[model samples]
Target: MKKFLLYFLCLISLTSCSLFPRDNTKSVKEHTGKKAEEHQITPPDDKEPNHSLLENTMELAQEGKVATSNFAVHMNSINDVKKQWGPAANTDQIGGIYYANYPAKHTVFGYNAKNILVDIRSYDEQLHQLTYPQIVKTLGKPDYLRTNQDDQIYGYKITQQFELRFIVPKNTEKVDHISLLSPNDTVATTTPPYILPIKGVSKNLSVTAWQNMQNWRNQMIQVAKNHQNFVFLNGPNKKRVALTFDDGPDLMNTPSIIETLANYHLKGNFFFIGEKVKKYPEVVQKAYTNGNLVLSHSYFHHDLSKLQAVEIKTDLAQTEEEIFEVIGKKPALLRPPYGAVNNTVITTAAQNGYKIVLWSIDTLDWSQMESSNIEYNVLKNIRNGDIILMHSDDDKVQTAKALPHIIEELTRKGFEIVDLQTLLGQKAYK
Candidate 1:
């Protein structure tokens, strides 16, 4: 059950969660993909976890008595759980998820950065629990059955938004614990909060490699706030970052990047040049069908900032046409070549229903840098909400080689690799 967050939510929500298999016409603006900082879940008032609320809401149930299962499973948010359970007895966090355990109550609650309850669990040995035979007799076969070395998990659809599971020991039939979880809930790390460290990659390193680009990144963010058509530069500071490639759909590097991304089950944003799409239609189509966003770079990778308004619009149209022919849809995003833009280019893009996509991390992979420096540029400067920039042109073989390492390192550090649509919660197509 523990896997990619995007696919998990999508499949569980019937493709309604806008992560993968997203609705083309619907904007996923509601879900803010902000990740939580690495820290223990603590009481907001800086007080210890107490049972005051456990006593206060002891009668909130319709049955005129406390129903711990109902309170633990049905609470709307972490705040609701906190109001009922006081605070967690112990807390741990990994990859934007918080695990707050209440041992005496035999309950644990999981929440995302938004404080939305992702799951709840209870494991009280005192309570007479159901065996596998009893569960099958009472519930009439589980909706899903999963067998592991130590246990067999039986899951039932508890409601539209959540599932109820019972874990039974593999050798013994007796139920071990119960959980109420949504598809959005990622499995907590085996050691609770331990994220494996990559050998050469550390997020805490201070790398002043591209100090000018960093400064310019700040300036672009400020400018983007003033421009309605500029959708986003980077996402909120959190555990997720987007990887985007540019100037691609080449025979070698583009397909190589796409295959490598598929190997890791990650989706990338490909701002491909239109003219190249005609030359490599299959490569472009493969990226789209493989779940990558094939957005617009330009018709011929010209700098729109220097071009006239009509020229920019023409390039947009030509780019849209080429992509539409290859992928059968029009992209709504435009990453102006060289990240160069002016008032006219912004206005033209707005008039054309295209949002300009920019980056926060510039990898400079187009410079034919060695694979080590390429990895260094990304991992050394990686942060929450970063929009990474790299190239997939045929000449940039080093980029294709550096990609898998970057992805592996990122995941080992527990950063979710998401697409622009998921990170920005914006529409990818017109």
Candidate 2:
């Protein structure tokens, strides 16, 4: 079975595609909401769409010596498979890969005589399900869970495996069973060595577009590191340019900007004033729902560099509280009013746990330039890494008119535009 699965995976690999889902818009943070558990099963050795598991397993068993058999398959390389199963494991002829682990955190890999992963019933303590005694009886008493209020239900940490958590029901002392893959499971995968081919596009053009995106994203990170402020959003490949509209949550133009971004499958960062969010809760919600990063621009668009420490703190905190009250997420990034920042501003921003973001490129669309000029200037000087500044509301006529062309022209020149949150590599405010 393992050999057959391997061969199947190999054949799939030849086509430059993956069976794995590729949608990445979902944030990596764990969602606590109730969800149905999804379990994945390996498909047939052939792409003919077979779903008979019993028959498949039987056939694999008949094809003995699968261990030594070089059946080309595709889920991942054999070497990669070997890494999952460790050394000291041997393969047998029954078909699939099998492995075992002792009481300690070590793995043994091989095909069992029955050709299945070995999960021996070491000690059954199902009765320990909801009691403090369960912990003592199973994995020994907790060193920390007992002391932590949040972890009273169940907690266990392996040397390298995840820190186990049991979400007990409210008012219940007993643990409600829960399991998680260890933090090690969350290690970032190395960048794919090659681009997966895209269908319906010229192969060369697809590769070039992918490379341009990678370059642009890397450049955004490099530029962000030089400044104390700046937060990145979205995946590195999507786009890195921040579309900030100062003095908004504007009722007039905010909706249009939101509509435009949504149409393009993109979002932006809104450095809104406190007054705006309080006044237009709907607009604030719209931005958040659209995946835009709603950050603090101050209670009013006040220059932080000129404010006294107390005034600066008051302004920042008030803005943060107002924004959070409406959006349910505190702003982690702040754009100083008019992009002004100094030592005082920097210290104040740091104290508030907010990074100050500045733009690398300004479109001056606020001047309400001809949409043609706005479009031309932005595209002409655009590079792999850039942050184009334009207002969401003030230059409504010019910005709205220039939006499509700016997108088309920049994209044509091999530049990928992205949201500020992605460009700065920071989590969204929410």
Candidate 3:
């Protein structure tokens, strides 16, 4: 009986141990079923998984897996943006790109690798008013902003007290571009207050230089009224004063002369070197538009009297081409380089359809004389029909200093300053 009880107990223990498996593989279906239930309960829309997706996306972008942020979208008008949030704005052009208002407060337009308008942004402050010529003079470019069948848009911005963006457009046939906007939010419709063409003289100039010339003309008319004809003059009496200038349309100095002349109400003949005009086309255009005659000094200030015939021809042609390219008016007047024209030089100029113009009185303004002395000599030498010569190069600093006195003295005297065109009764090429 004892043996049977012990055996029975051992068997019970063995069966109990077998029924409960020692390894995790006790019921494979039950383990899988539990895992599946846990997955279902976790939910697809949980925050932890969503966060992981965002982090992965950011990391992909940082790795340059994408060319650009898919967040990019076009903005037609800036008015749509909230002023405070200030979303990043940029413009992309071929070969170039720039961010808006990164370092400064002025409205800025930057060029891309292709030198096209890549970026534009608002700026703070009012900048000095810039003319089209001034713009070209400073920038040496014209950005093709937009174009349609009727007109082409050119973007111009000024950096000053307040940033101003100007959208200038040119008609297909006209040489001038009308201002489409101003800093004052003034919409330029037919014409802006003071605008010039992108690359040439206009039918009329309303720039500061032109206004100055007009003022000078009015003053001259009030006095002698006889100072008619453009840059040079030869009346029946042949008693004329040719107001001739050499070397300029300087960006700073020329404008002052223009303003002084306007104050006196006069115009004069400008003998420009090709290099200088190329440097400051806008100033030259201002001269041309104001009815101031533009004449050639030389292609590179080489005296035609000394150069060979081929050299002279090449020089003349190059200068003429530059002038025509900027003013759309080829010069018909030639002032031999350094006033050194001989008969051969004259003949060459004549062959090229240019009239050889010589000065009657040299002011020697090009010399480093005292400004007052220069002023006195010019004033003292004035005659009823004298051709007075001066220079426009900044190196001719005396001329700039003496200008106001000269104009004031001339105004006091009876002689009127007139351009060669009105004086010569011949059409000007520029």
Candidate 4:
């Protein structure tokens, strides 16, 4: 009788434990106030899947690699995915890329038009949903880290094979989702050298541009040795010239100009007006990331010669802040608007930790001259250590047209094209 009573008590204890779910104190709900159920996956028919249906789906997914209801990562057939998951609740196509969303499972799958599964993603609710702190604790440091606009990402390599991405949303420290992807399909593969572009421009451009600039500088040093009377400023005594663009990072023209520079595997120095930088910050960012030097052309593009010393300082400070916000760095060089400066401008720039940069060869592209004239002016007077000035912003269509020709002519003449930082042997930014 006593043995039977003990067995009954043991059974009751087991039943009580089974009745209570393990308390996941670190669950998403505890931190974000949103229940896991609220973020439940949406079904294909634009209706919510019943709890039992979702539970069953999740159970099936848990048995797979990425936890999708039917198909798995790297799955090749669109028909197979549809046959398994029924249909996506929502589908979108952009630039020939297709994306399907299963709201009920909190999963989205992407495929090429050919229907090859490129990637699969899970949203806020997952079996191992973790905060950023917990992720770091579990995964250690990430192999790569980057920010996209506002969201931050931590990337890891698992066993040197598959890639894992942890995405932390802006303003919230908790990780919103985790993606398991093929290493080749991750951003690391797309952006080479494995480093994020400083401002969305490839770091490869920066590396190549710097190397070419240095080689040119070395050549110029030898030339200066032979000709004592040769006077060059801001560049080494070699036959290298720095290409500088000023006035604007206009929405339309700057990107094309950047592309042109990239095509030649060359770098340019962009002197951006403060207001324009505010308007077209991304263009300036691309210039910086593509291995170009970004400097200040004053905040308002006003002639520093005309502004008071205090006013000039304020203008420069404002511009510096704007540049820093975009690139996470500050300009170390300044170009007074109109190439106009007084002792006050110089003193203020010095006080503000900026070196004043002026052009050696003015292309006069700002004159809205003919493309032929702009090309002629640049190629005609170009020499070693010459800072060739051109305008990138504004409606300077002719300048844009002549840019490639100028680069080609210079390359043909054995002149190395570089930014002012390379020519002057100074840091581009602070």
Off by over 4 Å in 4: 1-234
Score each candidate by Cα lDDT: 0.66, 0.49, 0.48, 0.60
| Model 1, runs deviating above 4 Å | 1-218
Residue 223 CA displacement from its true place in model 3, Å: 34
Ranking by TM-score: 1, 4, 2, 3
Model 3 Cα lDDT, one tens digit per residue, 1-430: 5554322212211011121112121111233543211322222232222333223323432332211212111211221221332322222111112122222333333322222322233222221122333333333334323332223223333321122122222332211212212122111111211111111122234588556545543433322211111112222234446667888868777777766676767787789999888889999888877777888888788768788767888899999988998878788787776656454564465446666665545565654356766665566655555667778777766677788787667767755666766665555673
Each candidate structure's TM-score, on Cα atoms with residue i matched to residue i, is 0.51, 0.46, 0.44, 0.46
A best-first ranking of the candidates according to their lDDT comes to: 1, 4, 2, 3
**lDDT score of residue 387 within candidate 3:** 64
Cα lDDT of candidate 3 equals: 0.48
Q: Candidate 4 — which pairs collide?
A: 41-103, 41-104, 41-105, 42-103, 42-104, 219-238, 220-237, 220-238
lDDT, residue 217, candidate 3: 37
Considering every candidate listed, which one attains the maximal TM-score? 1
TM-score of 2: 0.46
In TM-score terms, candidate 3 sits at 0.44
Considering summed lDDT, which 10 consecutive residues are worst modelled in model 2?
A: 12-21
lDDT score, candidate 2, position 51 = 24
For candidate 1, lDDT tens digit of each residue in 69-128? 455333466667656665454454434445566767766666665566676665656322
Query: Backbone clashes in each candidate structure, one number apiece?
Result: 0, 29, 45, 8
